[model samples]
Target: MQQPGYFAEDVLPLLASLPTWPQPSRKGATRDAEWILWVKMRMWNRLKAQFTGIIESDFKEQGLEEEDLAWIAGGLVDAGSATSTANFHNIVLYLAACPDVQATAAKEIAAVVGDDRAPAMSDVSPLPYVWACIEVLHRNTMPPWAIRHFTDADVTHKGFVSPKCPAVVCDTVALQFDEERYPDSFAFRPERYLGHTEFAGDYAAMADAQPRDHWTFGAGWRVCPGTRPAKSNLALMLANILWAFEIRPPTGAEKGGKGSAIDLSDDAFDMYPLRQARPFKAGFCLRLMLQEGLTVEAAF
Candidate 1:
């Protein structure tokens, strides 16, 4: 069924703007803009209506209010869509920038999932190299900071005192790039994660003694609920994309002879509350031609 697809365009910017603390003066303006967008776009209203219908038909006994249901559903949609899109964009950019890495992932996907159909969830377990690539890319491209968390009661760690009720942001980039944990720290090498089969969420859950894979998903009770699904979907997407096409940066001539060349460096990213790769040219060459109307299930 057709559904609203404008959350990225309408709601994400509002959400992102709400947390920006670059200047204390802009806080009021940001909230005003959010309210204006909420009224003008009515994206949340549309979602609320859709959810209301579902609850009326199937969950009337739960006594759930439409506003509560809408907020719950909207939270999931907003949380998943923006982050996932940014992540997928970052993956494509990384693949385009590093052809060798892409080639390695493609080979792994090819060995695990033949050209019969698109990749499926079942193929994820056998594709460790591809997962490594994703892990490395995520480490490099995740948002510099995580969602702001509050201090619960007065807390002291590392000899710093944080008063309760103040917003505390987890510095994700700093943790991920710690030289002690990630040797060389700045290089994009999937080899670091190779043979490491645990997902980020798994590592987040381990005891303090157990070395975690990455902090991209945060930790503790506030860890991203979509961690496992996001990883599976990413692996599936990487596999399918590698199976279907070869990704490359634009040609020198197309890039205006280095004057405006695609930037594979960290400078190409916009590090706000979310990490988003700026627009860059990339070429995708089709590597496989599937039968018309073919589905992943058809391969079985």
Candidate 2:
């Protein structure tokens, strides 16, 4: 996991201590499952410690008390890293499977962010196609459910009515795939979002933004606080990746098979509350060497 720049110094040790999952073995599937919870617990403990340290040392002037630390740590891990990792996993899977989309995005990135320098936030304006690809991926792979709201009182929307209820789920899968909203929705077509300047958060904020960009970031007053940084980080990552390498699925020889095919279906993802692509392979060939004077931090 990449540490947030502002807190990198304080959290570097925590990043180093992150747990590694046991490798899958012929007889280890069941055994690995039993220990996965333990690994997750260890990870959370390390993260919580790191967050507390940062809060006490770095943000001491903010006047936050000890009791607030656990809640903040949980939010940082669950609301930030987990979702970003899943999004990135989906991006790589889609790019490897769709060579044409990959090529188009790379071409656009090359035009706007030449090999002389790393991609910067300034390049976002001219790279609509790349953003479109990202939007499509977000729409397709969004969690099956968004934040669940318990009714504070009776309410109705459109034709449906609800009395006080324990939970009301906004079915993300249904909303994203509705044929009226996204024609031929299952196909990975970035063209649908061409000329759209708004990020997912922009759409989420609006009461009625036609051709809603995406719902990966939950909508309304409770929308994620990390949306802006997430968008910038995602753009920079994708731009730098396309600018520096050619992404493709592994060849048949590499897989020890006559032919190789990347699965781009629902079967490719694991059964997780947050959608995550299962481990798969993609090949990256260098296109442009790292430019002079670009630090590792800037390059990423």
> Total backbone clashes of model 1?
0
Report the C-alpha lDDT of model 2 over 1-300, residue by residue, as the tens digit: 121242332345454344434322313544665575455555657776555555557554686643345456556566777777787888888887888999999989888878799898889768999878777767754455676778888888797888887677666787778898888889889998896677677777777856577766666566778777776677678888888877667665566732258798889886456677888877666774434322121100
What shift in Å separates residue 280 of candidate 1 from its native position after superposition?
A: 0.4
> Which candidate number would show the highest lDDT if scored against the true structure?
1
Which pairs clash in the backbone of model 1? none
Per-residue error (Å), model 2, residue 37: 15
Model 1 TM-score relative to the real fold? 0.73
Each candidate: RMSD to true structure? 9.0, 11.8
Give candidate 2's whole-model lDDT.
0.69
TM, every model: 0.73, 0.70
**CA-lDDT, candidates in order:** 0.71, 0.69
* Model 1 per-residue lDDT tens digits across residues 1-300: 012232332334455465456534356666776775555346557666665565556554677554455556666777788777888888877777677888888888888888788888888999999888778867753556677688779988899988889877767787889898888987768888886798777778778824777777777778888888888888888888889988766655665633223466768786765677877766666775333422221000
